[model samples]
Target: MEWTGARYADKPTVEVRTWVNATPERVWAIVSDVSLMPDMSDELQAVQWVDGDRPAVGGKFVGRSRHESFGEWSTTSHVIEYEPGRTFAWAVADLDRPSAIWRFRLSPKDSGTQLSEWMQMGPGRSGLSYAIDAMPEKEQKIVFVRMREFEQNMATTLAHIKKLAES
Candidate 1:
């Protein structure tokens, strides 16, 4: 069935936040260190630096991501916004549409730094994501049974960051 856009609207796009038990500055030491992602993420297979310095605004990097449910996906991201210990955002592009923005904002609180991770998927990206979400209903459902796995993946990744920051 061809999508009429309702399925795209049903796709859940959300930000996952956690109160990290460390200062924003401390957390930035990890998140802003772009080279470390492959080691921390199970899905990001590799990051090949394209130009400019690591984690700087306007820098570009190409990477590959692999998931059991989605196989391999590739994209190059350009840093859109960067602030020392407060925020950083990037746009991943070159597939079929505008791009998706991944943003992280840090706010200091009494408990620790509040880490909010935001993902804004573009038009076609949302539709494509909904198609993935719809894959489990087919007769042979083995293809993308865990299609929305990024939700859990991001949660776990954020938890890992919390753990690393605390100790």
Candidate 2:
């Protein structure tokens, strides 16, 4: 099966935002720790240490998560950019698709810290990714649905982190 790009039902991209009642440093502590993701995110089941320093630019890690129909999926991320208490980004690779990117940004605010995550799929290409994309429109919708789920999961994670930091 070949999943041509046409499978997408023209759904708008998904984005979610959440704020934490902790300083950037505090938030960074939780986000930068790749080993703790499974404990933080409701969707992400586990993260295995791949390489590189904690949250440092060039760091690599693999994470596993479950989607509605996909069951369990794994993706690896490489830290392309890192700024202490400001911004951190990861270019995801070696999964169902090769051209996906996930990034996280941290900004300080009067209340605490603002954290955001974003992901983009396709255009890069991989045999498996293309094969999966070949499925029907409903299958294509899973990715978007997961993105939204991640947002809410992340929001809850942030809220927990906030409580931990404030404590």
Candidate 3:
């Protein structure tokens, strides 16, 4: 991700994909369980369903994340898209006005499933915006570094999911 001077308006995204030697059902089982996400992520420390027992659209969840540079924070996310064995997506913070959108997609392969994890940064206020506001001159650099961090973390997350699904 080269510098595009991406700001909140740019809504930049980072995605990582991998093929797992498992059925779509198997992969979906792992991805749908938001509670398991922390075990697969670098920044996320925990997640809990807010009021619903299932991953249906409109359901909410709270996630706690710890970042080395940014510190720890929590956010409530609303399930925006939920299709069992195919896709799961959520919007962080306000559903009508999200700070970010995150998704997990699964597709059937010959003997396995292709799984992808993707996330798009905000077009609204978020932790990043606070940092940018404090150091307006280095906005591009800050966004770039954060995007890279997201990329690496997403890749690691995919790898962990693949391992779990295959085993």
Candidate 4:
């Protein structure tokens, strides 16, 4: 991802995609299972369903994350979109004005699947907001650094998923 000098209010986003040598159904099975994410992610520590056992548009989940710089924190995410074998998305903190939004999209390509993981941070307040508030002059720099971290992490996640799906 290229630097945009984004600020928290800009709602910066980062996405990473990979072609998996597996069917969309196979990829969907993995992506939709939030329980599997903590293992694939570096910052995410755990995830548990709050309302239901499986993915649903109105369901909720709590995710525990730990960042070396920011420390550990948890967030409740509401599932905003759920389309079997195609898309899965959730909004963190608030349904109407989320602090973050995350998504997974899958599409058939050739004999495999094209899978994408995307996330957008903040039109609403979040932990990062505290950092920005403390260093108001460096808001853009902070946002840029965080966005890059997300980009790298998302790429690692996709690579892990690709390995799992292709195996």
Candidate 5:
């Protein structure tokens, strides 16, 4: 990914996509299973449903993650979007002012599925905000670096989902 020079208040985002040799239904099965995420993600250590057993609009889940710079932390995320085979999204922390928003989108492509994972950093405070607050002058660099990390992690996650769906 290229430098974006984004700031936290800008709600900077990153996305990664891949074409999976499987139906949208197949891809959706994997993407909607929040419990499966920890295995596919580099920083996510665990995830558990907080309200319901399955994905649904308004349902909630908790995710535990670990980052070299920020250490380990957990956050409650509320499902903001859910469309069986098309889209799934959740907002971390406050829904009206989320620290982050994450989503998965799927579309039929030829005989397979086009899948994309997207995330927005913030419109609210998060662990990274502390780092930025500590070095106000380097906010841009901090946001850029974090976005890059998210880009890389999202790509790896998509690759894993593709492998699982295609198999």
Candidate 6:
């Protein structure tokens, strides 16, 4: 993935895709399982269902993430889309004006599944806002760095998911 300086309210984003040698069901099982996320993510340290029994449109979850530069923080996410074996997505904080939107999409491809993970950094105030506010002159630099981190981490996550699902 290469940075193109895509922006939303001055925030950049990263999206990565990978083809996994497994069925959509297999990929969805891992992708939609919030309990399994922390293990697959580099920044996410933990996750838990905040409401409802499992992931569904309208469900909520809390994610705890720690970064070397940003330290640790937790955010609440509200499920905005949920389609078993196809897609799962959530908006972080202030559903009406979210700080971020994250999604996973799965599609059948050559007896396997094509999985893509994407994130859009805010149209509203988020954790990154603090950094931008602190260094207005370096806002673009900060977003670029964070998006790069997200891309690398997303690749790792897709690799781990592919490994597990294929096995």
Best by lDDT: 5
Worst 10 residues of 2 by lDDT: 3-12
TM-score of each: 0.76, 0.72, 0.95, 0.96, 0.96, 0.93
Report the C-alpha lDDT of model 3 over 72-129, residue by residue, as the tens digit: 9999999999999999999999877799999999999989999998999987678888
lDDT of 1 by residue, 5-27 (tens): 22332332557888999989999
For model 5, give the RMSD to the true fold.
2.3
Model 4: lDDT of residue 3: 41
**lDDT by residue (tens digit), candidate 2, 115-138:** 776655544542234445666454
lDDT of each: 0.70, 0.65, 0.90, 0.92, 0.93, 0.87
- lDDT per residue for candidate 4 within 1-167, as digits (tens), equals 53449778888899898899999999988899899999999999999998565699999999999999999999999999999999999999999889999999999999999999999998889999999999998888999898999999999999988998989
Off by over 4 Å in 5: 1-4
Model 2 pairs whose backbones collide? 3-133, 3-134
Clashes of each: 0, 2, 0, 0, 0, 0
What TM-score does structure 3 among the candidates reach? 0.95
What does the lDDT read for residue 66 in candidate 2?
76
Per-residue lDDT of 156 in model 1: 76
Clashing pairs in 5: none
lDDT value for model 4: 0.92
Any idea how many clashes model 5 has?
Answer: 0
Q: Considering lDDT, where higher is better, how would the candidates rank from best to worst?
A: 5, 4, 3, 6, 1, 2
